[model samples]
Target chain A: MEHYNMNLTLKVWRQKNASDSGKFETYPVKNISSEMSFLEMIDVLNEELISEGKDPIAFDHDCREGICGACSMYINGRPHGPWHANTTCQLHMRAYKDGDTVVIEPWRANSFPVIKDLVVDRSAFDRIIQAGGYISVNTGNAVDANAIAINKDNADAAFAAAACIGCGACVAACKNSSALLFVSAKVSHLALLPQGNPERKTRAMNMVAQMDKEGFGSCTNTGACEAVCPKEISIENIARLNREYMMAGASADK
Target chain B: MKWSELFTSSIGKKWVMALTGLFLIIFLIVHAGINACIWANDGGVMFNKAAHFMGSTVVIRIAEIGLFLGIFLHIIQGLMLEFQNRSKRKKGYEVPMGNKGSKWYSRSMGLLGTILLLFFILHWWHFWVPARFIGHEELTEIEINGVHMHNMYNLMQYTFQELWVVIAYVIACISLCWHLIHGFQSAFRTVGVSNSKYMALIQNVGIGYSIIISLAFAMMPVSMYLGWV
Candidate 1:
């Protein structure tokens, strides 16, 4: 692996809370290793903050692995830094040149209010999911996984949908703030599988209603979500979600 | 806000966008088909008859309401999604790497959409509103073989006779075609039909349909102006 030492300028957002007006504060770091992950660089900055008798900048993180969907940051203009299918934590300094200036900010959206510096409230996503998702599976029954016998085709589709980590990266990448990619993945994952059939209609209807209620934008058929998705989720899932929604709307009176 | 439930779960705003987009796709196909009928005959008789029928009582009223709702839902949802996505973008670090996976049109849907909106306004002002309220006299009147037609044919011919009008129509058709190319497949994908086994086939079919319909509709006026049936 290629290694290099680099000096960098960081312009980071500083926010006290959701209501506070945020601003960018610049910090300089010298002699950073090329192998350091983006979050590790933030860790170094936070350490400096603590040493300076300042409150360390707060940001969300879990699983330093890219799967948890907790560490969301817009690097430059793109959703998850520069690398395709990689999250902020997975982004290595090698992707940047020495002496590069990096601007780091929390995700900007009305629905995702700023929680603090570098972290925003993404809980609107939860309300949408809770409104509709998951079939009313019985707790007592331990049905064999193979017993349901999902087609390999459906299984593959579900696996693709399951790849969505709920990162909201798609929302960030989209110009319209559309969440169709994320929601459709979830809907399609279940809808394509027979196991999800029982609640398919309700799931589509309720989830869509919840999404609209939360004041998210409609899909414009732009593939930005797929473009920036850390998991590389396809817009196909969104189409599936649409089909499910139509069917659900048609049968809503039932 | 329950943080655990939000980022950890799917089935949120994304699905709503997908669904609404797909619905609009259906509407576009139907609308394109209706518009294509304008070029079906040498004279505009068949087209005007069809337009008249479409502009008739019950169907027209239902279509008006549906169109309003459809456009409203699409715009509202599109804006919300953009906002949500904006909130999730990573902060301040430029990547020199070019966008690899997305199609050009997919990335530029907003621009195309804006163009389409402008076209819609012009379309309404030129055709729909005048046809509905102003009648043919204010626009242009045409009589062919003793038929007291509304002169929609003459109007179309006259409009396309202008070079700028022809160019505008072509540009609008291109935009519509590009929009539909992505929109059609996207709708299918959102509704869960994206399988690699048939993904390319479906994409091709979707693109074909979009191009054919948009080109057919756009070509009607061009043909009229060129005096080519």
Candidate 2:
């Protein structure tokens, strides 16, 4: 719990654009505070780069609190650095020591093409959400929470699935770049609720169709996604997704 | 969803792998059971009877076609999945995260399947082709209770006599062990057995089944080669 200062070497990925062949560029940071977050360390390094008249690194980060799912980039081979159930924004420099070298790179996947230095286009996730990751709810006053009368276990599981922050860490961690963890989380979050009953079948079917159309790879159940998930989403949702999709295929009217 | 999409969709394709994989899992039990008859040691009379029954019975003969089809679909879909999955990551990581996320064998299904495929081809050539075709010249003819049959026991004995063949078989079984260790629970997971209560059970069963089946298979060749039977 003691704070300390450390000097570190960073090998960061740099690319002009999606079409540009990216390469790693190394930078040296002096006296970084252990109490600073990983992104804060990057911010310090960026400021120094700007002072040196070099183009500062471009990375995606919205909430430094780790909820927005924007903070991404593989730090030393792991998705969000060497922490369990943690994100980049929550990763502190304290995890490292003096004179350690860290290699950072953007998510590597055909579906997630790199847009710039340490940033990839993750709109594929948006499209998959658009493909039935919702329920048909009438616009009106907020419904009473007690009206649903959901099972406690189902509600808990649904909440767990809902914890997914739409981060591409699952896909980034996956060797196949499969988005099943993300898709399954979305599907299970809704599918487990009674409000999600009407379009459950179509939701499962259509979302998967869109997932495949987006050129994401099929899942091989390697548990890599669950391992690197920032929110610690379980692959159990993937099994639920598979079950939902199959049942929908078997009985859907259309 | 169109019926065609049943096999075309990503989940659909996984369903195929799981169903076919489960079928093959069952087939392994039958195979190991029949092969265990070698322990009867009555000069392979029991083993030969079981092999002859499997080869000659009308019901089983028809089922054999289904078995081959199951294996064929499992292999083809496995290859397609592998190739497609590989293309998803066109760019390789600068620093590899080897076995940090999952076990090596879980991520190496393609490699293990390829090894198993090569082994199967040799296995079929050694036993299946001759038992099914190539006439009786290659197989010794024997009669049990007036029921004449090809002596597959002799073929197994003869084929395993060579050290290379025994070693190859054992290596293949080791690969089979690794494959089943992942595939068994994976098949259950694919079929939607996501309940936390059953997950641990399935995982433990998968590991035990993989070891037992593969060990039984590996021992067959070893036993034959060493003249233990």
Candidate 3:
């Protein structure tokens, strides 16, 4: 790729805390390299702000390589910029050109309130996981890895669903602000395996109940969540989740 | 899970949508088939007989009640879901991402449903109210094979004669087309048919169903108004 430099304007959201009504503030950066990651470009802008005796824009980021699911910027009206199946940190500044204006905002959902500039409290996801995102463990001896014989296709799909990084992108991208994709991914990740079978019914029931209690909206099958997910979490998992929930609801003793 | 959760929970709400949506899908097929009777072009003989049978039978009458109930449940639950979903996002984005993440119709179900509701009101006023309440005293009473019934085919002809009504029905059918295009596969997905093989088949079948049903409906009015029937 040919390296180039460009000047750009960024309109970023600024919020003091959860209670504060946020607004966008624009700033210009000069001579930004196209090779820099989107987060690195923001770092340069932040350094400039700090030098000018201003509050630097605070955004969440870790493992800039894209696995951590920490970076959650809604860049240019997309959860992770315009790239398909890419994370915000992995997005390159080359996606833009000279004199371009980029708009960046945090994930906007009632359940995930904005804690500060570009960082919303995503612990709601944590609570949902706490509800039932686990399988029972026997504390004594380590079991053989080959003990559980799994089918190859289901194992691959389970692996794919497990790749969801707990990012709030699916919620951010959904028109309803629904967390179904996240919950479904979590559900499918475990439900496909025999180890996850014992708790499967309660897991689906409780997680969905917790998700609803968090005030997240219901799924409308709009496909937006699948489109914006950085981990390429398939909406097929959502259907599987629905199947699990329905069967559990119908047959579970509780 | 408790039985009440089927009505009160989020996934439960989706089950309601899926079930009611499927019911309505079946209703549309029946409705479109009946409407296609207009193409028989037999001077309203066969059309009025079918319409009379649908209106007068006891079992069909019971089923009509269920149909209305299904429609009401679909509408009420749909609107409530739309409102709850809207409230989940307190603040709006400055730059709207229009149709990049999902198709416009999928996102605009609420708006399309509202339009369909309005069309339903007009349609009921024009056809159903007169047929059910006012009796054949208002419509021209005619007999076919010793069976006397309301001349509903004449009423349809009269209703479609107005250029504005024809246009409105065409627009409503267009909206229904888009609504069903998204709704058909979505209903199946909600009902747990997420396997890739079946989903591919459902998606194609859904597209065909939407186009064919809406076209059949739209043609009823267009052909009547243009004297093609």
Candidate 4:
């Protein structure tokens, strides 16, 4: 791909700590390559900050590859920049014009508090998952993947649900601050498989309880999460979560 | 109420929201069908009779109770879910601004729902309660083909005569339609039909159904005020 030299301006969020007052700070970069990924551009800016005697802007990233989902950013008015099914680390500078002004900030929600510039602690997701994501399979029990022989349809559905990377993008994207997409993905992923059957009742009950405890808003099904999701996880998973929950409630009565 | 249980437990308030939302979808379908009868040109006799049957003492009482429960459950569940979502972000993450993946409606459900709730109260007070308890005095008596008829048409026309009422009704109808488009398929999905093949069909059906219902309902008042019916 041919790379074009581009000039850019960034209005980035800056916070010293969680309790510190935060604000947007503008920075200018000259002659950036259009082929550069969004995070790589940020790397160039951090070098500029450090050399100029300023603290490097803090942000999260693990695998520069999209699979890790470590880089989370809202570019312009979009999550993970403008590319569909693309994470921030994978979004190329080519998507923008030569002298574009990009507004970047941390995900805004009462549930997500900013730890530093462009980084908010996302451990709420970990708490939600720990609530009851997995079935109690013994470590020593080595069951073959084909041993259960799940139907092709169910397996596909389960895999799709499992594709969720526990990214808080859905929550950030929702106006209600609802985590239905994330929670539902977890519920549907397990609910679709046979191994999840043994703890289905407890799983549904526990996960939903954990969801409420975490302070996530209820889903009104506006489908914004599915639209912004890098994985394009569907709202149907939420419905399945509801079904699993209701069935669990019914069976618990017996 | 335990912190661990609320975040970790699966069969809690989230399920309540999903279940109540599904029930309301059923109610909306029945309501839209009833309102559509106003367009039939039978001197409004069929519509009046149907309305009367629905307003009968026993049926009215049952419906009143059900409506109360449905609205109550929906609102309570909604508030609880909102609280839970807020609590989770006590500590924030380092993410950027502007979520392009989300839609306008998804973020505005709270506002839409609040408007719809206000409209529901006014609707009940203006038509439902008055027709049942106050005995439809707003309607005039007319002679139609040697038969004595009640001018329910005139009553409807008069209600829509005020520009504010018409405006409010129009706004409410739009909000209701928006809510239905998301709520309809969502209710289905919550019941566990997330299959890709079927979901696309459901989403389309949901959108079409909401548009048809909103237009059908809005036309009745507009047409009545314009003296077309």
Which tens-of-lDDT digit does each residue in B1-229 have in candidate 2?
7788876888898999999999999999999999999998799899888888787668998999899999999998899899999999999899977887899999999999999999999999898888877754548888899989888888888888899999999999999999999999999999999998899999999999999999999999999999998
- At residue A235, what lDDT does model 4 achieve? 77
Give the C-alpha miss distance for residue B173 in model 1, angstroms.
3.4
- Per-candidate RMSD, Å: 6.2, 1.1, 1.1, 4.1
lDDT, candidate 1, equals: 0.73
The collision pairs in model 3 are none
Model 4: number of backbone collisions: 52
- Which stretches of candidate 3 lie above 4 Å from their native place? B136-138
True contacts kept of each: 0.36, 0.74, 0.78, 0.53
lDDT of 4 by residue, A113-198 (tens): 78888887778888878888888777987877777788898888889989999768888777667777898899888888888988
Candidate 2 clash total?
0
Please provide, for model 1 over A29-93, each residue's C-alpha lDDT reduced to its tens digit, 9 standing for 90 to 100: 88889999998988998898899999887988899899999998888767778898899889999
The local distance difference test score of each candidate is 0.73, 0.92, 0.92, 0.75
lDDT of 2 by residue, A1-254 (tens): 99899999999999999889989999999999999999999999999999999999999999889899998889899898899989899999999999999999998899989999999999999999998987888798988879879999999999999999998999998888899999999999999999999889889988999999999999989999999898889999999999999999988676
lDDT of 3 by residue, A1-254 (tens): 89999999999999988788879999999999999999999999999999999999999999999999999999989999999999999999999999999999999899998999999999999999999999998898999999989999999999999999998999999989999999999999999999998899999999999999999999999999999999999999999999999999999786
Alpha-carbon TM-score of each model against the true structure: 0.74, 0.98, 0.98, 0.85
TM-score of B chain for each model?
A: 0.79, 0.97, 0.97, 0.81
Candidate 4: where are CA atoms >4 Å away? A138-145, B1-42, B75-99, B134-154, B161-164
Candidate 1 vs candidate 4: which has greater TM-score? Answer: 4
- Lowest summed lDDT window (length 10), candidate 2 chain B: B130-139
Clashing residue pair totals per candidate (backbone < 3 A): 43, 0, 0, 52
